[model samples]
Target: MDARDRDGPDRDGREADFTWGQARDFANQLIQAHSGKHLTDLEIKVLQGSWQNHTYEAMAEQYTYGAGYLNRDVGNALWKKLSQALGEKVSKTNFREALRRAWWQQGRSVPSVPPSVPPSVRPSVLPMTPPLPAVPLAETPFAEGPVAPQSPFYVVRSQVEDLGLRSLLKPGALVRVKAPSLMGKTSFLYYLLQGVQLQGYATIYLDLGSIDRDILTDLGKLLRWLCARVSRQLKIPNRLEEFWDSDIFGSNDNCTAYFEEYLLQEVPQPVVLGLDNVDRLFPHGAVVEDFFGLLRSWHERARISTLWQQLRLVLMHSTDVYIPLDYNQSPFNTGVPIELVEFSPDQIQALALLHHCSLDRPALAQLMAAIGGHPYLVRRALYELGTGSQTLGQLLATAATETGIYGAHLRRQWLLLQQNPALWQALIQVVQGTEPVSLSPLTLYKLHSMGLIHRHNNRVMPRCTVYRDYFRSMHRADSP
Candidate 1:
């Protein structure tokens, strides 16, 4: 009979052709063969979840565990283990077929399709640690408040991970990180800096925000500060007098000369210069344009200049570059572009665990729905909950109010909305409904840049539940 021959009695003499036991047995065999090791307790549960084709969320509900981890983290780890074991690429979506192709060699090939779960019984045999019990609000995890930026609590998610261990040998390699305020732009840059250093590269960090306004007012003055900072960090003596030539060389050439002639020679390794808060330059028109243009000139130099090739750049900013820069002249347009986004539910749970919070899976989901995984907000919740400052329920309820934890931050944004009634009314559309509302492109850009909304295709929605609830409350109380 053909493989498709149908309507046969099952092992239990039922009409069904497949059973969970068959799928379980096949999956276990593949795991044992390809994983090079017996499946751990959690790994088996993960395999079962994948075999059943249950959404991580559905499986989490079944097993009472973190959906995010059970979905991707565990899946990724399992696939990685399989890939190593079988010397092949394996992922959750196709691991079964990959195994089937191998199993065919033994002449005991199981069916390619997974067995269907009967409507009646789905066993949740996953053995894992139960969620941490919520602590009292008074025992807040972060009694001192926000962890220092780039603290150990920073949890990296799979989606936002673009700066992997890839070689940066490409000359003039540039990376631009753009996101709205409080989106972890600074934190991401620090991580990149650390990665490069581990790769035996030297890094110089320049926070343009720290440059005095007076220095930025003059091109020569700012370049001098730049040279001084880089040289200082490099431990190279500042040879300012040796390179100064006001009439003979322009500021751009002068700065490049300082790096080429006097500074870089002291260093024997490639330099990764990480620039933070580039938005500070937008307001200073001539200064920003000329300075950015000078930076671009150096990037262009790498094609022919070995000295410049030794230099790499990482730029971080909080908004769209409304500065009207030319393509070749804007550093934002070139190099690998990455945008840090809000954390996913799984990443949030991982971070919560790092903070020593025992928040359950449902609580984690509810938290994400409320705050949308705003890096700062999610961390704040975990920190507070750990310190026993507020229960998860309490945090959600008081989130949008004037006296709430985010009161000051919400008030500042509310003021901006009040100043622009059009933006206020546009937000009203999003707040009043579950579906996203359409807005003009520039309008959407401006609103999203302010971290006020998130765009879905041509429509706009509040960035998170916190934003919607807070704004709604503010409209009733403050009318902003």
Candidate 2:
């Protein structure tokens, strides 16, 4: 009844007996009351062990069970029971906290204090936040933003202006840019367009990804569409209308010639073409050949009183595209190839600072450990840190979980390993080797590119602890 009465000792000189059974009963009652489930003896014992802050391996050892068996049987079983009791599934990582809260409500002491914040949670200190606004999928005439230097389009502008792409803008001059998805390919094109616009050049942004393969088969329709896009971007009044009204619309070769000879060549300003996902057109070889041929012919034959300074062509693709430029060679091999690498740790720090997060060296190292400076993943993790209410440690832990982008990337690598058993074997061998694993060039390149493994001392190694643990957990069968 009184505060001290329940916990006070009897005349016998011993303190109050806190038997394991009493703990189990208390846990059971809490589960039944709060979670609407009855705990069996084993489940109660498992809960009691977890309440004591016992590791899974220790629990398994104490119960004379295998680690996997304990996890699957006791751990998962407790989760299901708690979910049924709480009306929502509880993750295993949070189970101890939930159980401790239940005990505290009953005036019981927690068995142990949880660890302090994990090491990965660090602050960001970077500048230059991403400037591009997320465009809605349904929007038309996508709203334009500032096309200034130091904008998100800075890289593209730098590329175009610094590289003198404007001078090389000709029908025959094909430009190739290589980067992974969401690495600012579109933004770069917009930057290039700005240069073209400033130089009194007509430009066409042809989104090949949005085009149908069937449309490419009809060379006449493709030419007409290209002309219309050019007209729209250049604000050429009645240009598309005049073309549709002409007899060239019915003839593939004639329409191609019309666009080459009149639309592109006769424009008052020089014309630049921006074709996104140009690789998608490779399937239609004939159409692609004819289109490039027309462009070449226009470059060679077009004659006006004042020759346009440049005919700029910006072609973007994810993978290499081999387009024949000359009779003896392909067009893809001729142009300058720019490969986009992942952001450096310093760049990530810059981004973190832009978001007003603390990206100190430790934090940067931790983040790079988890994501390897992949731009999108680093941006996402930083965004979570910036926007989330959780403590830095909690955010980092969340980032490590499979739900976050870092986890998703790790999962992708795991799945790839599963698909190729040899690769997985090689990975495990490398990780477990006393010395760094010397991998074949092909395997090393693949792993490095995927951001799963890194090179150290000329050997392949896991990128982070999460990946190392993943391999270790799965290596149970093969591990001694």
Candidate 3:
């Protein structure tokens, strides 16, 4: 067989097994050369899935995106772009045939397609993410699982409260989120990240709490590890050797330059890097200061350079306590600071309803009085109540006791306080007093940082009745 005859079936066979990697390459070249626009990751996913005789529903299942979004939004936009490039109308339904004909006219292979069922005969499929079976909404408590951004249990009354986080998607725009633990800071960050996911952005969620103590103990290694991990999460090949210049440039500068030159180039769209548990770095004096300084510079760089704008930051920390970096060099002092407080009574009621609790307004208010609308505690109480594992009265009664519903949580806090006797004693004075007590600034900072005390002006008090009652009993019974 001559070259033309020999190549026909082989080209058709390759089309039958056509995959995402192939479609992405061709679509990228075509669109970039024609319209100067590159196909997004989700768009490429849609293209290959569509070419394989997959309907939007099937493609959505494969891509873990909404079918309507895939069909009405991405699919329509994609076909429009292809039509503009190919100079003919193209669509998901006849994509293979159209592509074949187009390729024929252009003297290219017909990337035909695999044998597959027609759209009419296609069975409904579930997404790659396993979903809970349909049940009474309340019985499937929102507290029992990772709350989706759209989950009814996850409440957001207004966008104004989020400090434009949802809308501030530009590169280098930094959002500093501060809240005591369990105040829904992470959940709020998740809401923000989910918003970007719908807009075809890449996001990385790194909890510094997950960082190894070994790395945290040293500055140089920590920065290298962080750069490596962020690169890995972005699916970009790490070129640490090319970026690191520890002997000449400082570690922070090297890390910053790496992201600017190598890392940012690999990302197709804007990036949202979420640094959770920022307090984890607070103990490492020099490292924390320099690292935050680097972050501050990154945010500032966005103001001047267009490329730096692709690196938006959302930093979440659990305390007001900060390492004393120059005010100008600390990302904490600038940028939008979002402080998440406990849920309000109305929010608590909404949560209860979402949890399927049969609580009246008075009962919810009573629970709010007992737990002060703390997200984790409120959700825990509602979960147990909704599941019939505990009554509201039963929860309230045990909440302050060592063996109560919050036993593990309370114990963890108490243990942390025990490690710092000064903090423990200051908490004692705050807990036992009729009103707020004055403590040393560092002591007060520590207590507030633990989410165990409320600080205002120069005085401190137990954060809630649960903390007061539990610690008051412990303080009175223990050695003076």
Candidate 4:
């Protein structure tokens, strides 16, 4: 055959099977060039498994992702991006040949992934061993707020934690942490901020939930609150009057100047500012646009300005931003987005052991069957068990009742639902249905944010058996 014909598929047929590693490197370059975003670890696993012809179910078993998430969420988005990059249709079934053709067209057989920098040559972004203090398992506390930095009960969420840390190390990084309430967003935020602080980066954490309603409604007051908080956290005097001139500069500009002129300059090291419960301001349309727009502008400024590069933002929220935003002016579109998921059975068991509440495999399974590895719920159960307040059986029996350990929590959720009839009805449909029920995006977002439901794609179900049973019983009690 001619040399030209030899470079075609017939040549690939005679060669060894294309290694997933090489395909991974090839696709990473292509996708990054096309989308300006690198493949995530989960996305990499999906690509690797597909290249090996492994089913999504098998991949899920071998990896941390769920089969449905692998198939529906990650896989669908990946294929579309690959199709755009390769200039042809790409799916799990046909990706192998498509990649092979692209491989030959590029005229390179070897992987193009860059070599890792040696420790000596690498930038000193993080310490080799971060000084994370250890808490004796027996002395670990069951605190209500974020887990202490030294707590042994803090179960390291390997994937999400690694991603967040790596993103923060980059100059001018923006890391968005989104999860339902009480799913340990605050706990994870503390863990992350502690890591950066130990690295010698100046860290400031502010929870927007603590901001008053009047301040949230007024742009100037909100900006002033933010400026004052950052200054106080940095041990600097409250100089909002010095930097902020509301009459001359707009609220956004005033906030930016406060950071650019004072906060960033005052801190000798890189500044990592984490804002928690950012969604608290979502209700005020005017504030949401201007505040988030300021954030987006700072992120963009980091790309070229050296002073702005010193600032990195970490935003922690419990739900999606439902309001409209300018496409070019929203920080959400850029930056590393993280969604905290429920814990695995293994993590739950490890935490139980830390609490010194040893239970057999079957007992642990029973607990998960009721609560499904919710971080706070699991911690609370283990805490109660550790305190000798209730037996495993007793806890399970009364879990859905008002007298149970989760009584206050369940009541708060019920109160929230009562305040919104539409949200209440939406959750009712999900709770009563045997299968996942569909709801409007806003309703689903609110329910998920409240930790009342779990969404698998467009459909949602009661987040746990506790919610399902509690809501169902409440409905029955109200029936005539």
Give me candidate 1's TM-score against the actual structure: 0.69
Please give, for residues 1-480, the per-residue lDDT of candidate 4 as tens digits: 442322223443522334554467557657855775556656777887776667999998997569998899989999999999889998988887787777655534332222365555543232111112233555767747787644556666668887997799789999998876788889889878877775678999999998889999998889888898989999988778787787887888888898888888888898999999997877677788788888989999999998999899999877533323222332356799998988877567556655666665568768988998888898889888877778999999999989998998888788767777767777778889999988887677667767778878878888889999999888888779
What is the C-alpha lDDT profile of model 2 across 1-480, one tens digit per residue?
A: 431233332223222333333435444544655644445434655665665566778878886668787679777977787766645567555554444344444333222122364535422332222212222223211113222322421222223343534344443455667654445566666666655564456678888889876777877778777766766676665354444544534444555545655565656656677888875666576777776666555444434423423455667764322211222323345455665556666456545544546665666777677656545555566666655444456756756556644565556556656766766788888766666689887667655644556689788777665566556666774568
Q: Evaluated with TM-score, which candidate comes out highest?
A: 1
Any runs in candidate 2 off by more than 4 Å, and if so which?
1-161, 164-173, 216-220, 237-256, 282-309, 320-331, 389-392, 398-401, 406-480
Per-model TM values vs. the true structure: 0.69, 0.52, 0.65, 0.67
Q: Count the backbone clashes (under 3 Å) in each candidate.
A: 14, 18, 2, 0
Count of backbone collisions within predicted model 3:
2
- 3 versus 4: better TM-score goes to: 4
Per-residue CA lDDT of model 1 for 1-480, tens digit only, reads: 332222222323322333333333334444544543344445656766665555778878886779887867777887887676546898766665554444333323222223475524433221111112233444434523323323435444433443522324345677777887667777777766765675578898899878788987888999989998998898878788789898898898899999887776777888888889887787677888788888787788888988888888877887644323332333446677787778766556546655666655567668888888788777777887766678888888898887878887788787767667876787777888878888877667668877878878889888888889888876777544
Best by lDDT: 4
lDDT of 4: 0.76
**Between the candidate structures 1 and 2, which one is better when assessed by lDDT?**
1
Q: Which is superior by lDDT, 2 or 3?
A: 3
Model 1 stretches astray by more than 4 angstroms: 1-151, 164-169, 320-332, 478-480
